[model samples]
Target chain A: MAPKYKLTYFPIMGLAEPIRFILSYGKIEFEDNRFESDKWPSIKESMPFGQVPVLEIDGKKICQTIAICRYLAKQVGLAGDNDWENLQIDMAADTVTDIRTKIVSPNYETDEEKKQKKKAEVINETLPFLLPRLDNLVKQNGGYLANGKLSWADLYFVALIDLLKFMIGFDITKDYSNLSALKNKVLEIPAIKEWVAKRPKTER
Target chain B: MAPKYKLTYFPIMGLAEPIRFILSYGKIEFEDNRFESDKWPSIKESMPFGQVPVLEIDGKKICQTIAICRYLAKQVGLAGDNDWENLQIDMAADTVTDIRTKIVSPNYETDEEKKQKKKAEVINETLPFLLPRLDNLVKQNGGYLANGKLSWADLYFVALIDLLKFMIGFDITKDYSNLSALKNKVLEIPAIKEWVAKRPKTER
Candidate 1:
């Protein structure tokens, strides 16, 4: 019997999109249970770690976005062929995570002026220093984020680019041809395309 | 032939300690290359992603402290028994990472007043909220961080607790009895004790 999967998160493409992409890629059926933002505060105390993007597999609640994605990656055979290769894939995913954290830190700033300043720094300094390196990595790896073949990291990067652009209000990949190509590659996947076409539209 | 291992980081034991602990727990020999902070600028450009705690496995350099630790965990048989178990371990480790990031962010603040305020928030707000939950997890797992056994998450937690204390200038585990017991359980490992006995002493 197929194990039932359900993901709980806000109705936005933030952290949960990568897990959603992985499930869509594998054609696995899952409950993408997205709640409204106002409902989060009431439900927050009951979450396993007081965070969203929790994946319930066979009724076992799993916390952490990357952990959920990694599990799904393993299930769908999108993980590395060997332990070492898996490490490389993880490294790529983590690099993207580093970028995401830098971009989102400003979003959470309580002070509006400070938030704008931090956002500027992230766009001007952090993005320039990091995105080129990531582009080179994808280029060197022959279009994939880790190895020559597709992995969950590729899905993670493409999914995150949408959020990144939305947060920064700019085209983050305009100059990076490889990343753009990689984004297109991920978007072209039939399952991913289907998910994108049908997934709920949100402001973020 | 066993793969050659080399860890590059500042003389301080921060992120690299967890990787060292995993290697030590497995009785694997590695070169602990600690460099002075003054020498970082010259070497910074050469590092992958311009960060320390880079693990060089057989001359190949891997970036990101968590990625390096995860790789070493697999090498030392400290990883989970299966995909689901691995996800649990990863979730535990990632939770620790989240706490660590919150505590360390203030360390880089340029303003003294802001830094102190942030530090206070980390101690008064963050620790109070996160530590008890972590301690409960340890208690529920029968003294281990995950899987009711000594996974890399256990080692990672114990190793990082020292750095956490140094950065915050207080014993973080004082109020959390189960976490303290978990630390003792990790510290009592024969190989881990051996590593601690001969390891370099540094002020974080």
Candidate 2:
């Protein structure tokens, strides 16, 4: 019997959107289960680690967004075939996730002064740190993160750049031409383009 | 020729210890490179993401501790044989990692205050969320994280529990008896036991 897959996450796109995008791009069928804020307490109790974005495979629960994404990516043959390429893809995706978790996840003060301070740190410290590295890697690896082919890491990078623009109101790829080119390249993929165009509109 | 591996990080365990532990337990030889504060600037520039704990394999650099550990784990067959089990192990390990990253990674005012806050949050949020779920999984699976066999996730839990105790200066597992037993059982693995005894002491 085919395993039944269902994803549980908040309505926001913060962590769950990438997984949704991956499944959509792969043309895999799954349920996108969103929970209301008020309904989270009781629902949260049943989750491992009390976290959402858990993927239920045939009624068995699996937690961690990256792990679930990678699992599905492997099933869809989006993860690179060889060990070396897979490692590179994992590294790129995980690096982006780490930066997002640290600088982009926290919502601090609403005051302009504090927001600007946080934005400045992101632009100066994190953006500068990540963009050039990714640019160089793309240049070195012939424009793809792994296998010089469209891997999940490429989609992850596109999602990350999109989120950065949304959160900070800044264009990271504008300065990094290579990354801009890479993003355009990824969007050119038929499945990904379709997924993006038809993706559910949710506030991140 | 066997590819040479070099790891660069600060002296503290923070993110580097897991990679170190996995390599040591797997009996894979690698250069353990530590950097002093003064040397960080030069070393940091060389890192792909300006972060420590980058792994150099065959002179090629890879960033992200989780990615590196996953790569190493796969090489030593520590991840798991099948895709499903591998996903489960990765998910569990990453879930624990998320909690640590959120609650314990901050530079709190002092050890006392940090411990107090961590203890409260662990009891309230983390313990209730993770302990029973993991315990149930272990009980059902016959003690290991996946496929009824030891995996890197099993070892990761051991490291995580030890870190919690080290950080809070209290026995956390006392409350979760199954977790306490799981930790003890993980420690009994011969390779892990030897590695634990010889593991370099660090302020994790």
Candidate 3:
């Protein structure tokens, strides 16, 4: 029997979207269990670590978005063949995570002054330093994020691009042709395209 | 033939200690390549993503601290037997990583005023909220983290405690008996004790 999957998170494509993309890509059915902010406090206690994006697989609940994504990727044939290859894929995914955190920090910054300063820095300094290296990596790897193939890291990057653009209020990858094309390629996938077109619309 | 192993990082135990612990536990010999701060500029470009704590196996450089640690953990029999177990281990390790970043950020903050504020918050609000949960987890798991037996997350947490204490200016685990016990247990391992006794001493 196929193990049932239930993903719990906010409706936004902030972090859980990567898991969703992998599931959709694999044509695996899962309960996309999203909730609102007001319900979070009540929902918090049942969680393993009082965090969201908890994935319920079989009868057990697992925490952490990356952990969930990696597990699902392996099931869907997106993971590498061996340890060394997986190391490269993990490195690329982690690099994307690093960039994502920096880009999105401004959105979560409570202080208005710091938010403005961080936004500027992310746009002027952070993006320039990071995006070019990522662009180069994509180019070198022949249009994929890591391991010179369409691994889970590529899907993770594509899922992240939408959230990144929403948070930063700009399509930062417009200048990076390789990244833009890569995003397009992933979006054009039949299942992912269908999932995107039919997915619920959210404010963030 | 055994693959040649080399670790590139500063002489500190900051993030590389977990990998060191795993390698030592597995009796895998590795070149502990340490570089001084003054030589970092020239060496920076050679590193993947301009970061330290890279582990090279037979001349192939692998980046990211957690990724490197996970790869090494699998080699040393510290990783999980199955995907579900690995997910739990990854969650535990990531939770520790989150707490570590919060605790260590003040040390890296350039502004004195902000650093002091962040330091106070980390010691007060952050530790108070997080430590008890982690302590209970250690207690529940019987001195190991993530699983019922010893896993790499346990080693990772133990390695992180020393640096956390160093950065925060006090021993944060004194009040958490389970965490303290877990730390003692890891430190008492023969290979780890031997590695700690002779490893390069650094200010951080």
> lDDT by residue for model 2 over B64-172, one digit each (tens)?
8788888899888788787888887888788767656644643332355655665677657666666677677777667776677878877776766656666655655
- Candidate number with greatest TM-score: 1
Name the candidate that leads on DockQ. 1
| Per-residue C-alpha lDDT of model 2 across residues A69-148, encoded as one tens digit per residue | 88888877789888888898998788778667655633433346655776677777777777788788888788876667
Reference-based lDDT, each prediction: 0.88, 0.76, 0.86
Model 3 Cα lDDT, one tens digit per residue, A122-202: 899878878888888899889998778889999999988878888888886799999999999999999999999888876
Query: Which of the predicted structures, 2 or 3, would earn the higher TM-score when compared with the native?
Result: 3
Query: Which 10 residues in a row give candidate 3 chain A its minimum summed lDDT?
Result: A104-113
Please write out the lDDT profile of model 1 over residues A1-204, one tens digit for every residue. Answer: 999999999889989999999999999999999898899977777777778888888998888999888989998989999988899999999999998888888876656887898889998888998999989999889999898889999999888877888888876778899998999999999999999999998756
lDDT of 3 at A64: 78
Off by over 4 Å in 3: A107-111, B107-114
Which is the winner by TM-score between candidate 1 and candidate 2?
A: 1
Q: Estimate each model's TM-score.
A: 0.97, 0.89, 0.94
Better of 2 and 3 by lDDT: 3
Show where candidate 2 strays beyond 4 Å: A108-116, B105-124
